[model samples]
Target: MITLSRRHLIGMGAGALAASAVVGALPASAGVKGYVQSTIARMSLPEKVGQLMVQEVYGVDPTVDDSRNLSKYGTAKGVDVVRDLHLGGVIYFAWTNTYDNGPDGVAAASNALQEASLETRPKGRPDRPVGTKVAVPLLIATDQEQGIVTRFGPPATQFPGSMALGAGRSTKDARTAAAITGKELRAVGINVDFAPDADVNVNPDNPVIGVRSFSSRPDLVADMVAAQVVGYQIDGKVCASAKHFPGHGDTATDSHYGLPEITHTPEEWKALDAPPFEAAIRAGVDMIMTAHLLVPALDPSGDPASVSRPILTGVLRDQLGFDGVIVTDALDMAGVRQKYGDAEVAVRAMEAGVDLLLMSPAPLAARDAVLEAVRTGRLTEAQLDEKVARVLTMKYRRGIVERPLCEPALVDRIVGIPQHLEAADEVTDRTVTLVSNDGTLPVDVTDRRVLVCGWGATTTTAVADALARLGATTTRQTSNAPTAAQITAAVTAARSSDLVVVLTNNVATSASQVNLVKALTGSGTPVVTVAVRNPYDVAYYEANAELCTYSYSPVIAGAVARVITGRVNPQGRLPVDVPKPGGGVYLSFGDGLSY
Candidate 1:
């Protein structure tokens, strides 16, 4: 299994040129190949290494500029280093994305970043004409895998989560939601969405990806993944990464906390986990985001798939034939960061065959590590050339070279517009799943006394608004965590009212939520429970009627109320299976009973 490094041919240019067919294993686009090759030819070793590292947007201030020392670039502020470090991209986390994150602020930041990304100092850099603009664009990427994983928003209309879309079961709706998602992202100059999770939610007890996945069935997940790939890539040209590949669905462990493993054999892997990824590739997905999953069946050494040669190179690149960009999940996660520094992770990840190093904590240090790896005869120059060329091809394919900057006025106008909200409402209306009922729903609000007890800020308001609008004599009580007195008050209110509507969250995480629901139902009044976050609540507490609305967005809440009042028939099916209280099957996958 030993292959010599191509470091011996550093000075030999034309003779050392690798096969064009194998250079980065690009898509069948010849022009992109030529552009990538030419781009690679002009870049320095430092620039090429820098292009592989993607950093978080912390300390990145595009507004700051410091003069170069004719031999080196000085000063800090990550955004200014776009040109200095020749960075590949910066991922927007919640902190930086929302720091002074007004529409105008985002536009200014984006403009500054693009400007720096396209221009460079005339210091210690060669192979470029004086004052010439760089043709490459940074991959402005973020995790807008909406419905739990959202980085930037408020001006963006909130769509129902992915599992909700699966329950809705319309590929068109899924695409439309992502179209809106993409357009809003592009409005703010984010050109890549690390989204449309391709994991099939087969485990009922799966923690991180319950409502995030489209469905428990592989076929349904494939459909939603393909649809979202089209939706994000089509209109705004924002690249979509069909994510957590080969699959992160069935694992009980959270990658954020510890490494999760999949012990299936190769045959079982293909049958259960690989379909969505296969479908995503077929759908022309621009990027595939790898998970930190350890598949002992694939790689016996127990390397996380992010750095597993068998998985990334053998399975993803060779077996599945995904020629587009391959990106690692955030390198800072506990799953992959076990005693590995930025330098070690960056070098090995590239060796494992990933194109992009996402969310490296010390990105500059990482760039230097790879640079040292190349110079010290550890990593080959040929590897750097191919990797950087692949990234350039991706930038070209995404049209970022031509149009890197976003329009500020258009951003304000297009993002979170009425049409987007309307479309979002339409999708949520379809995604509300009526789990079960004993004829307790459509709680007539016309002069009927109603008691509303809900969790969270938005959900409480939305439920109260819907009831008030429906002509119900409504009394509202809100608590994410209710005191004993508060619980008694809610029960007292429920007893006095004709019917009670309860909105709750996270029955699996908190037993207090289960207790809250039990107390509300104890009044023996006709009680309707809406699982505000996770749908597994019905397994713990019984309500006269139960519905699972994947999101508690104002629009989704309104839509939930409409469904309960029989305004819109609850059409969404259960995307994941819900286990029974005593530990057997309660609602199987695809179970949704409507009035």
Candidate 2:
């Protein structure tokens, strides 16, 4: 008889796991599939349906209800919701006040939820004298994508966003960053991360997915996506979810407020949008979150991909051969809720073959709808069992079943340690992209006055502080939309300073910021412009020297400072094309410079 430790099984990766199953090298109970089957057979219909739901709740403590959550999401006390609804998972958001108390608080809250999920319960009647513990454990999840989308604040290592990694063009860096992120998440008991966005980001004007996506090139995105999948799930410590399936990259719309439609032909999709998702599937990603957009090439049913059988079942499952869990994006978003009510959307999503219903606005109503559908023949009990089994299988495969609780005391020790912070800084240093230089870079700050001015006080202050630490005298001016007085003041300051460094946030769309850059550049003081949010802003205006950091995190600001001061060479290349003012490409993808 062959025996494999849980550690060995998790490290085996998805391909190895399947191969092991084919050879019958382990007992049925030791294999995830067999354990999931036996667990499903013992579950009631209500319990089975509950296993398909993952809700978002408010509060740092599971036993207490936050009034804000009740007012905003209408969620009850965290422990009660998990116990009463028998939820298979829970998602935490910073806005929901879940991270208000920091890492230890998060770990404690996660332990409470897990305790609730593992509690014994009556088999049928609430008044029963004897009861049994819940069969499956909860999958605690969060969007700790880092960069601009981070949920955890300081004391947690903040890595650069996806585009920054894309600019660095190192799969090793991508994997290392994800591994650090996974370690921190597992330390706090979050087992699932909705991250490493797989969208190709072909549209420069894309509202939602710009820097969140790795790159515009499908091949590059595919490589980075696969690397991150392995990184997050390497030891089965956390499950990685490659999101916005069938692609949400080329749309000009934001799915949170409205529906976005993609006009890719079948050939176009196979070439552009399908590569990263295909790569993710081959990498054995734990989940693929569906996009709420309509892709007519894949599904002509007029329903969004989240509820389209042709796309979810036909394209993703049949053609793509993805046998893992399929999760829907937040059902409360306007993208998926445009036509259907809460109840109907829940039923239709299950019909379309999604395994998990994430963050439904009305949890009880959604669960009741699924139960009714199963009873009334709209959805078969067998279908419900299949979905629940997938969820259970993932729980076991990811080691959540055996280790549901986290140690709060160790959270501080394991999260944001020195080595992880150093890795983040090294990655950030490599992502500073110098797009243009006219012999003004590596500023001689020794005895020179430098003025740092721009939008976003946090970003400006960070840059100024970094410069000050290097023994340069610096002045700062911050305004989101500079007024005439602010512009005049900044220009006056620029004239007196030996050099001026101006930071811009989407200058292409903000005429005021463009005017600020124009006024400072016109001062003839040798200005260096930094594009903080998107690198495409540099095309709108002229600067003596320009660089793109892709994000405005303090770490990125420090990296930008070092690049300008010649302490670090700018090594990052553009991940997407930057359009010129007249509509052609000013800076194509892969454009960068070094001193």
Candidate 3:
């Protein structure tokens, strides 16, 4: 056990943090829970219920997007909600929803929001009309999952996503990547990162969480999940969350669209799905995001995991012994929204043991519902206080109240620094896994005619650009769900080329990609298929050679090109098991081939 001073532990914002050697050695006062409990005791009922709501804010377009999110970072509406609603936090979406101003814009927006939250009684908390306004730092959270799910653009460091780290199989590298990510986020004025998708991708055809999950192996996933928690908490001081719990791995449906049911029994969940979350709790992950999926074995009520007390309080809290905040996946999703209205969903979610109501379609309605529930005895005051205290405890632990803003001046310098990019690139190179090969790779494009084709042509274009820089002749063709005629033309073009390299993305979601690749394979030319987003494309059809980059971004393309040209040997092993559509295993977990 590594023993450190109490000052060192608290400075890292990890005092009394679980599964830590240092925190266990500290005095009881070093823990933030004590401070938070006392603070909650002084709060009124409305103020306490207000601390449970977390809303979503957008940018640029007010009419098309959330009108309240009209502020690029914040407008009067942003301040209005903080003052009037007494909401706990706001989830920011940059490019995901509306056009957002880049780094400095985000910092300024965050600073404005924080300032509004910390303002005077009349300006800050409109609910508390009499007493002095107790300014609480709102939890500013976003999905910074790095690779395909990253919310930040340009100035933010583009770290390779979770599957990349899973391939490298280094706990130290996982910790380092998370630390770098956390530091960059802190600099940009963003604090909470919804990351490290702890779900094991046991099912390859899983549309939502394909490469986002680390691996299918429970032990390996558990190890990386723990390391990621430490990196975010001790190093980044950013609250890291393990999401879609009880696992979203095997389900074939996307929770954002509809409620997916887990077929696994309780024992199966304990053995396969629950380990990563268990490891995260032992390592002191600050938050856990509930999935909207339903598990019949856990709760026969047929409610999604987000509103099931047996799953949240019984399975997560009692069984896992996790006392951290329980955040629900966006309440606006069709899974819960289609069945229940926003207010009912919010009250039921609170009743089910969720600490924060995230991104409800009706934010004020949700807050009022919780208040009404407490007042009408639908939800006991003790129950309301339990959830609010957890939220307040996390705020204090994260030091959001003390230092909620970042210097906009340093946003440019601190974000996307060379060290962060270099580490990201290194991780990308390591995750480039060659699943199978017939000696068609290492295409010395030196004066060779190579046809690069794909659905998302950006990846193919990037590879072509890199090859052109290396003095190689290349042709590029891209489309969204190519027709049979388009596939025939691509095959004809490939037949005349020296080598054909096909890039595939989201083939699991779109079955048409399989047909296109099958058409190209019939051309009798040596075709190399690279699964850019979904790594399971190789299971359906046999390309001359198969590879996976797990992402189709800038940093990833360079690494893919290097591996094909033999500049670098791929060191990535498959993080998840590749199962065919029907039944058999296409490739077991930890399967990767080197050149």
Candidate 4:
């Protein structure tokens, strides 16, 4: 590592600093705490405030302006995000076109952003000393939660969702999956991952956290959360985050659209919602993301956990003893913005013990608000320093300060290799739960005609291709909400086929899919229904055979195909209960059948 002294950082120009081999280098003997304290001591108010915000920019190149960039939030020009705002971190999103050309493109963009971040800015104000130019490297982060919440598309190994891993109940597989994901992320220059959603999905009707959560059982969720935290932080290459703290699993409302309330008492909260977070802390997770949820037992005030001191500081920081960084969920969400504007929301979260403000809709306004708060004694300078210190401490502990730049050429060699792909396929194969099977399975499809119908075009195409590759003569019907004509065509196609495989995504809520399944089952053909999104969909329809994959990725489709073809045995158990048409449990947790 190239070691730079304080004098060198101040004396060098922006070009010289960018060309240097190493940026923000710390001495080997200097402890992380000491380095962070020293760095914060010399920072200006603007510089210190900037270290607390992790903003988003829209582009694949740091210098170019992307059409999708929201200039009102920050700068559309990517380089300005680093130079003008001096952000502590930048988040990448597929919607912002940051992952446009895949791994190499992301790596190149990360390198450019880091170059801008490490460059020395001019000391203009009187309070800014000559030797303090703010040469800290950015903490690049992304939401690479694999299954349904993935930002990186193909060529990055697509692992199964969290509930699928929970169904398999293999901590070793969970650890291996996280290790592989962490390695690939580091290869592409991302230093932090917002993942391992530790929420316990006790409420089956929870709109957002269904398959994203590991399990309904708190003990099992704790075990999986600890394993993933250890896996992601292996070698400290990437920082793992346990999220939606205080739990978003039992709520019916989506926090993105509106605020959600959880009525669990303190006893119930500790028993049901706090285990995974406790386990994450024990496993030394680098960060914990606060949820935008209101729990009256934890804090009687109506403020959401993202802006509640009793919840964030009292419960998470003090009661749970989490000394690591505490980050908020995206500040632009309606859950936290109900009572305050962008400026007030940022200030309130900071006051409540959040160390990092993520994805503020108006990042500049938020920064200015915090600055004003500090000036007016609404928030102390010591409080701001404490938060910035936590961020820097994470950077040093995770080796982000030592290795800020990535080589684009190395990304192709490291990502989506044969080993990583095989691991993902194996994990997915182990997660295919055979809920019910009749004598119709393990069909001899060598020359048999089969009909495949599904709710999504991608799902139908993947399943059809997988079956065709296995020597079955395959025909596919794809529709989100099947029309009468579409259902009639599927029924006609099923009559000529030896067997029919229907994929359902939340069929319990979609009457059209239910009707489609009934039509196919009413025909004389043997039917196998696969609930690709949620296992609870099987209760809404009847079939000769039933299976649940808990996800809809290509890997899951291939695994389902192999399981039905008798190439792989079904080993997955249910992670959550399937409710009956009445009010009871249709299939309890841990219910599954092997071929």
TM-scores of the candidates are 0.90, 0.93, 0.88, 0.95
Cα RMSDs, all models:
8.6, 6.3, 7.1, 3.9
lDDT of 2 by residue, 368-433 (tens): 899999889999999998898888878777877767666566777889899988988899999889
Task: Give the Å shift of residue 28 in candidate 4.
Answer: 2.0
**Tens-digit lDDT track of model 3 for 166-226:** 8888888888878888888887667899987899888766778877888878888899989
Assess each prediction's global lDDT (C-alpha) against the native. Answer: 0.77, 0.85, 0.78, 0.86
Backbone clash tally for model 2? 0
Where does candidate 3 stray beyond 4 Å? Answer: 1-38, 60-76, 95-99, 122-131, 508-512, 518-525
Highest TM-score model number: 4
In candidate 2 the C-alpha lDDT for residue 488 amounts to 98
In candidate 2, stretches whose alpha carbon ends up further than 4 angstroms from where it belongs are: 1-29, 68-75, 123-133
Model 3 C-alpha RMSD vs. true structure (Å) is 7.1
Per-residue lDDT for 350-448 in model 1, tens only?
889988998776665677788888888888999878778777877877877556666666876888889889898889999998887998876667888
Each candidate's clash count: 0, 0, 1, 0
